[model samples]
Target: MPEPPPTADVSTALVTGGSAGLGQVIAATFADAGYRVVLVGRSSERLDAAKQQLDTQPGRDIVTLAGDVGVREDCDRIASTIEDQFGRLDVLVNCVGTSDRGLAGELTADRLHELIDQNVVTTLLCCQAFAPLLESSRGSIVNIGSLAGKVGARYLGGYNAAKHALAGLTQQLRLEWRDKGIHVALVSPGPIRRDDAGTRYRDRTDATLPASASAPGGGTKVKGLPAATVARAVLACAQKRRTDVILPGYLRLLIVLGNAFPRLGDWLLLKFTS
Candidate 1:
């Protein structure tokens, strides 16, 4: 947990998927740092839990709205509610995303589309509805990306493709919002444990004994960086208005290097998982 920042003006923030995992941690950071934090998520139970946790702070305003940003109506409704209540939004971090991991050819057309819609359409819609408020307040937007996006892996075709597309969206949005003083940045992360039923166990077991042979890092005894690491990266980018920040700095460096010399990435990924 981080100490609250010294600030007189309490800027408002809306964090999508703020009810759990990385989103929850990021929301806590904003609330602690003197922001009026609004958490958006699909689960009413989780949202209430998040709101209660955030409001426990002495000098904080925490709101929870149960809505899926993937839906346009939901995005519009939340945007309108925020504008009516807060007058301004200073930070918008989109951490709501879903991924379907399957080999490219194994996916049905519908599942493939769902993956794209879940990752790309959802973020685009949320940003679209909130752009006016962000532009007005010179707010910041952080999109969570992935190492898989930067460098594809076996058996994660749909997830990898959508994430790669998200990386593209981050770059384009930064350019579009640059002159307006609205910061837009991307945070690329290695896989982190998502808090769903048996997700952690499943990931660990699969990592140790992958179906498709052994990925190099697969057998390397890796723990996906904790979600807080991601929250920290988002915080750094938001505060500094950086164009891009990669989680676990070393992984970021490797991704960049992998992009230039793909074989190196392939070799590293294959060897470690094995």
Candidate 2:
């Protein structure tokens, strides 16, 4: 745990999925910057562990609420709790999402629903519940999206579709809430490396990777950006209120080229894999 800044001004920040991964890092970043952070997650045990880790800094307040953001009532509770306790929200970071790699043909209806509930519905409900508080404070929202949302991938059909919906939602919120003084932005990153990366993706049976995914790496040692890097980018997007941020920077060019020259973009994608 890092120490909060000595002279930093205080504010309130709510981070969903703050128990682990990128969300945890983002919550820590905000706490270090002197915000009273409220962490939301589904697992009480994990939330307790996260609270213990983040509550070390003196004078910095950290609260953890265990609830499913996919449920509307749970989201409402989160909003009410934050409102009664903090009165205002300066930041809202929506990071409660899951990923799955499966071909469209093999994906079951339940799996698709699960993906949507975990990713899109959670985001929608959280934002809807927190909007009034955010509006009161002229706060900012940072929605966690994915690189798959920008460009389609071979075996991530369901996850990609959900992320694409999130991207659209981010844009819609940005447009719809501009007059309300709420800043809305999206952070779309490439694959994030986790501590248990190998085991995390090992048990999946429904998806087969494209040759390109394993071209340079023989095994399942997929390369990815550090979660901390993505966390920093999330803060930057919130502070700057940028509409959309695509990670690695270079991916933006790929998106542009892909849109402008579809066949050439396909050739480039193939060339990279080959």
Residue-level lDDT of model 1, residues 1-274, one tens digit each, is 9956434256988899899778888998887777888899889998998888767878777889889898999999999988877778888998877755445766678877888888888889999999999999998998887766677766564777888889899889889888988888888776565545324334423343354322321223245677777787788788888887765677777667777898898886765453
Clashing residue pairs, backbone N/CA/C < 3 A, model 2: none
Candidate 2 residue 218 Cα shift, in angstroms, is: 13
- Per-candidate TM vs. native? 0.86, 0.89
TM-score: model 2 vs. ground truth: 0.89
Segments of candidate 1 deviating more than 4 angstroms? 1-9, 193-222
RMSD list, candidates in order: 4.9, 4.2
**What digit string (tens of lDDT, one per residue) describes model 2 on residues 140-175?**
999999877876655564887889999999999899
Among these predictions, the greatest TM-score belongs to 2
How far residue 119's Cα lies from its native spot in candidate 1, in Å, is 1.2
Global CA lDDT computed for model 2: 0.80
C-alpha lDDT (0 to 100) for residue 166 of candidate 2: 90
